[model samples]
Target: MDMSMVWRQWLTRHDRVRDALPAVPLIVIAVAATAVGNSAWHEPHWDKVVWTALSCVPLVVRSRWPLQVALFTLAGDLTLMTVVSHTSPTPAACLVAVYTLALLGDRRTAWIVGFVAAVTIAGVYSATHADSVVGGAGLVRFDFALGATVLGRTVRSRRDNLAAAKARAERAERTREEEARRRVTEERVRIARDLHDIVAHHITLVNAQAGVAHHLMRDNPEQAYQALAHIKDNSRAALDELRATVGLLRQPDDTPGSRAPVPRLSDLDNLADGFRASGLDVRVTRTGTPSPVASSTELTAYRIVQEALTNTHKHGSATRAAVVVDYGAKGLRVTVTDDGRPGVPKGAGTGHGLIGMHERAAAVGGTVSAGPRAEGGFQVVAELPISPRSRLTPA
Candidate 1:
């Protein structure tokens, strides 16, 4: 109902222009024919006046039924030639009709229709023409016939061009859509992989702790309570990170009642705390100036840290882990390294943990490389570009 809304609707929909073809050519032909008819006759009366009027009827369904219109025009011209022998603008109408038919039909059909109209017009002029049909009437009968044929073909050609343009536009749109969908799908897979790496580790920890509790409950009550506490903390941390990682699927601006917030660069601290509570000795450090980056980039950074910590918890047989967040003018760098020992019982080398870290880093124009430290343990290094967050947030 609103003007802007209507404009938006039209802008989004491309079919309107293509569908208006029937009216444009028909209107032009009508106006031209009327001018030519009046100029040719001194008086208001002419046999073609009736024929011309009849031509108007076919325009109603010109686009929906081009073939039928072409046939009707041909028949109308012939009937006019017979009935209004003394007053037909036989040359003009014949050619115009040919052009119309050609425009509305396919290349081959248009040609055939044009040829028929040409021949029919030429025959009528040659045999039953007025004494003044050509020389006195200044009638270029063949030219008119040919012109009409050409007009129909040209309209059809233009229509084809328009259709092709539409197709290309549609194809471009489809490609954009598919590309977006693919990226989202990839993000989902990355989330799944992160959940696998992080939550799986915690679940593993929970299972391990549960076993320790069961074994120690009979032998030592205090040790059993500590192990049970570890399981609870680990389980809760797993739930929180899982919620944040999967929250990407949610619509951020969804109407009113929605599920969760889309995690941004700001959510990195929460991510860190969850890992810390999961029984990893994770100390987050920062240096240099931090620039704002896109939401996508922020999410990547968060996931990288999260995955890195999960790796440490899973594989590090050592006790402490450190994360250095460096914000430079051009980009951000995160180095997550542990002395490869969680003080706990497990080791962290094999799985999608590192793979997920690399993916998240690469997504935001960053790189991740992880391996056993030359000194003793494992280290993961990631660097990402910082696109100012202010530029990315919606106004």
Candidate 2:
């Protein structure tokens, strides 16, 4: 798009064009200087001008073969110096070659080549002209060569540092993106577990109530009406809870603080009454003095109880169930047991309900165990932390 950008792209694609362009100005300067200077024979030396121009020609491929180019340029400079018997044209071509070698070649090789070039140029210049070494001409040439090498090395180091910094920034960005995705997946799983527990519990009660109403439609009209009323109440409750659970997907700013409160340990009494209304004799008891706990822990405990009871209703022949809550210094423990004869086979329904319970407890740094008692009943016990210490990973 931009003219400068287009020029840069063209230069990058054409290596010879880029490299040869710089040498053009240096060649012009060297030839002009040599042609104008007075020679040892009191005339212009066209041979010195030719040699100087030839020395700068090798600079076109300095990047491709740095050491060989540097040596060739130095030899040209030496020949010109010997023929002129006076101060030679400023060795611009040799300086450029040494800079390229330092920038592209290894440090050890650059140092060795730079040292030899400097010593040979300085020694030859001092030998040719009287008092040139003492007059500082030799030292000036030596400094120019070494200074170009140092400048090239410094530029190379800066480019390397920039590349490394960019790489680190890219890696950090990728890590942040991965962490955000992981949190989103975890939130989705949590919502799914909540929906499973809510729908399964209330639907089971409604089904049982509908059956009772159907069986007693003619023989017991009054009880039939009562059973139908229970069904209506349960269906309404299910819808309310379902709406709340699904509302988690809404934008946070849409209806701040409008979502239903999460169920807590104190709500166990109402939960038990719902089971009682569904024809199950339910009892709830608390042992230690209840103390405040984390909201996550309370939610986990509630879900564990709800899932255990739902499984018992759907798969067990249990009519009597008990819920126990014990508050200890470290955490809260919940236990649910039912005295039901084995109604469904051992591996009855898809065991997702039990799995949900386990996941909920483990998320809050807790553990859950559910099994049939030796005395012919099913039991679920969960130990939840007051403040979650560490979350357990699910298998």
Task: State in Å the error of residue 297, model 2.
Answer: 0.9
State model 2's lDDT.
Answer: 0.83
Tens digits of per-residue lDDT for model 2 on 105-124?
89998888888888888878
Off by over 4 Å in 1: 1-134, 137-140, 165-173, 176-180, 246-302, 316-322, 326-330, 340-350, 386-395
The C-alpha TM-scores of every prediction are: 0.54, 0.86
How many residue pairs clash in model 1? 19
lDDT of 1 by residue, 83-109 (tens): 666554453434444565677566788
- RMSD values, in order shown: 11.0, 3.6
lDDT of 2 at 335: 98
Highest TM-score, which number? 2
- What residue runs in model 2 are displaced by over 4 Å at the alpha carbon? 38-50, 83-87, 130-135, 218-221, 342-346, 390-395
Q: Cα deviation in Å at residue 281, candidate 1?
A: 5.5
For model 1, give the RMSD to the true fold. 11.0
Clashing pairs in 2: none
